[model samples]
Target: MREEPVKTKNANRLRDERRNQKDTRNGGEQTVLTEMDGIKNAISDVLEQLLNAEFKKFVWHLWNGVGADIERIPRAALENADRQDVVDRMVQKYTTNAGTVAVQVLLNINQNDLAKQLEVKLQKASSQRKGSALLITNIRFDKSSQRSGAEIDEENMEWLLGALGYSVEKHTNLSGEEINTAVSNFSKRYEHQCSDSTFVVIMSHGQRIQNKDAILGVHYDPNEHPDDIFFVEDIFSHLNSVSCPALIDKPKVILIQACRGDVCAFRDPTNGSFFINYIVDMFSTSAHKYDIMELFRKIASRMQNDPRFSQSKKLLPCIERTTLVKKFYLFPGLMK
Candidate 1:
């Protein structure tokens, strides 16, 4: 007679048996489709894509539950909670199913794309390296030529570059030769091989010599024996396709926030220069939605409409040169 067929257990049989026993003790069946941490992270990430007002609306809808199975959380409990706090509360209330509930809230708020993003699990999309940026700012100069508020521009630019996923190589108060060397070295960096684009931002006192834009170095002085200045054209030469093969076919943005006058650039004592400030504002608000050219147009439009230009009509941030083959969007927070 054949022996009774012996039962075989899989590798996770012991663990599943223990889980079943624990569920039995709780008097309910609990199936964990996604881990608690993963649920919280996905919900938090998707919620952050919403604007401030949209975020507030999302929080309100989340609390109301509207037509969902989630429990009605109190307003006072979430009134002071931030985004992370809300994620925590959602996960705590719904356990491993918070991702689904959060997706529903996003849909209710008309953020359908974001809702879809949350519904579909995402894996790492790119293994390429993050982009790189070169920032050169000259604030102080000889003969008491302190750029009263240039530091603000440096700080703001650094933050903006960082937010766009570019590791910024910042140089402050460098001489002309030093600035050139910095750019040359930056162009050779291996990061550009994997990066999609790069930025070269130079801010300083500027003057037009022989119809060429040049930024005055920190040591430059009108009466000085030797002039210390870096021609803006040389920057293009260093990062051009011939010189920087790594950046070939990539969008290279060159921003020169300096005046063409013989004297120092216009700047606020506390706030930075108008050009840099406008750049920060426009990029911060619209970079995610619009391309670089569109953003430049918006900035120019703002400058043209400024009340300050009503009298002189002189200072305006214009795109000096652009060699972009296609549109470039920052798509902030999408990478990294």
Candidate 2:
């Protein structure tokens, strides 16, 4: 019988519920899709504008260096420009500057470019079959009665080093006299742990002598002669002996982060010379591009410019090596 349109009650309820759920899901999905498309378009436009602006700026800088008016160069010259042409011009300009041409190139290459180049060089060095090991040591002692401000945060130092890939062993509550003994014992116990491809980093405070030598991290009481200063060289010197064969022909990196004497210097507050901070920053940003020596030189330069370090009349870092070339060679070399 064609009775009242055979509407099954249960089927009608199920159909309504299914339609409502689908509509809800689709509405949410449409909102998300629209938001994502807008974001994508905005990012694409920004990137394109940035790239174009940089290219135009490069051209302008090149024109200025050559004593040519940028206005004279047609806008069409830069539109759809050849990247190779820009690079070639840069090389030519650099060479001209090198040859004592009095032209000042105004290329605004960022520090990031420098960092990338250094990373490439480091990667290349590391690839050349050099050994690779990580070393860390943290030594802390009571501040000398004479030195009221020289406090060592041994716990933080140890934690920081370990974070930087070092195996840390803590020597607690040791006196200056006990330091030497502890270091000696620790060295003997782990001498075999180091390989030719090892990397060693020592963190502590010390004095800078003649802006050439760095003394070890130790506190000397008033009236104690400067000779009482413990030099990092002493601790590292033990590793130099032929008897300790594990470290021979290896790359050792010693990082000292303490004031070298009370000779205060004016340093730039924005970029002061905190040795540990500099080390961490440099390694994190440019370690891939530069070898240890080059990286150290940059850090030293940064320290010099820092106003907070202006009082550092002659603070310098010391590197003693039997063979400078072999010792400073970074593993994996520079990357292409």
Candidate 3:
């Protein structure tokens, strides 16, 4: 009887040990699976939050006139929405706008199929008698002195203008009086030079005070006019229809690279100053006949939308006389 009882007890203990082992194994597997699920959920949540934040930032930047660097965004991110659909929507939006449609569609294209039918609009535009371009850059660090960048700016202007087939005559370090004299000489020379299509670009250090506008430069001659004088309106006014009938009705583009007032803060890094660079890049790559005003607007929009230049509100081309809404178009190469 004692042997029988011991045998039974051993059998029961063995069964209990086996059951405990199985339970322990199951518990460990459950714990691991639970931890993995939690980690997966947490990761998903973080990605969702990040994507939402970035999208909001992009929209905000675009609306504020600071252009977002679309290229910087990951392709996977943009894949959320069909890229073709997005582009189509953007085209529709731009084309439907009041002034945009008139200039982009009506003036440029007589019919809807015309622009699309052309294999190369740039070549076509180029074939229609090459026009002349003139670029002027004047950077005066102080009222009395001119910086090296001024000359560099002028040289860049000359090269770019020359490439565009303009007989460019660039001048640097000219005082206010000299500018007036140069303008007069330019007017006379310009009339004598290619009397067909012409373009003039002026880059300088300018300021807009209450009602008066001023362009600063160095005075070389003592007998010359004052260095810091108000001649902004006077200079441009000279290019009136009556003054230059040959240039009348022709596209006369003027670009001014200067500060509008002393209230601007130079807190942004130099790399952020991409206005001139962007213009150059666009000009070089542009294969179609682009409207100058439209180009300026696009540049302004890009600058205003970018986060790096969020603080800059005054960096825009001050256009007068011409209707920018009616005049701007990108050349064929730069368009698509």
Candidate 4:
């Protein structure tokens, strides 16, 4: 992960400024705060500007459901409901890659108690703790590479991950066997073994397996001929419960930025592919306000608006498996 020395310095400076802003009359103590409060305060900027004035009300109504008045509910039950549990009850989405649900809905559900828990977690800043690592296999093929745009995408990813304090390991242009070795070895790394979560990113030229939807890598043997590419499922096979015990309860994020087929849609010689562009765009503005799936939805919405998209159908980004028990946040600290 690369950083601009100045951005880090500036962000830290701003953070310090806010901390010492002196909200109270007596300078005896700095302003008190919590993680959940911080998150809600940050997102309030977006919510305040919402065009649909009644969106929050509607989400709350939906949460209350067809019956069961809020008036009758006991305070004890409300006090006990956690944010993660509240999220599970409020939204019914694909078990795999159900992505982040609406922040508005989250704020509306048991708003007091859940926020308190999240606030505590946030202030602790556990996401940026040591031992956490991110693995990236950025394949810009040596000969038939993904173009200069891909390089920019790699830089962007590094910055984003770095900002979140991830010790990012990037492996570029690997063969099928090498890719397997890299991941197999990574799963065993001592750093990740002690970490709370992991992210695996693969970018390459890929093809769909015959009659199947699995993505295949651009692996070619020394004979100067194409060979068996990786089966995308192998990603999970290597990291799932029985296979990689270290990541059993931890969040394992897999993002594939490869071309799924031989087709090309709206790619720019300067800006790069649609996926990479929107990825940066979404993450650049996102401040832990939405989950990875919710972020993907934002990307999907933007892709739908592409000038050439309606004319030339765009490929959808695969959700793969989203067996996350709790929502994950990159929680980038300060970008360089």
Best by TM-score: 1
**Candidate 4 local lDDT, residue 153:** 54
Number of the top lDDT candidate: 1
Ranking under TM-score, best-scoring first? 1, 4, 3, 2
Prediction-by-prediction clash tally: 0, 47, 11, 4
The TM-scores, one per candidate, come to 0.64, 0.43, 0.50, 0.56
On residues 215-240, what C-alpha lDDT tens digit does candidate 2 reach at each position?
34344433554444445666676556
- Whole-model lDDT values for every prediction: 0.70, 0.40, 0.42, 0.51
Candidate 1 C-alpha error for residue 176, in Å: 0.7
**Model 2, position 7: C-alpha lDDT score:** 16
Give me candidate 1's TM-score against the actual structure: 0.64
Better of 1 and 3 by TM-score: 1
Error of 4 at 82 (Å): 42
Q: How many angstroms is residue 105 displaced in model 2 relative to the true structure, after the best TM-score fit?
A: 57
Off by over 4 Å in 2: 1-164, 190-194, 197-231, 259-273, 307-322, 327-336
Q: Higher-TM-score candidate among 1 and 2?
A: 1
lDDT of 3 by residue, 24-60 (tens): 3323321111112232332223223334544344333
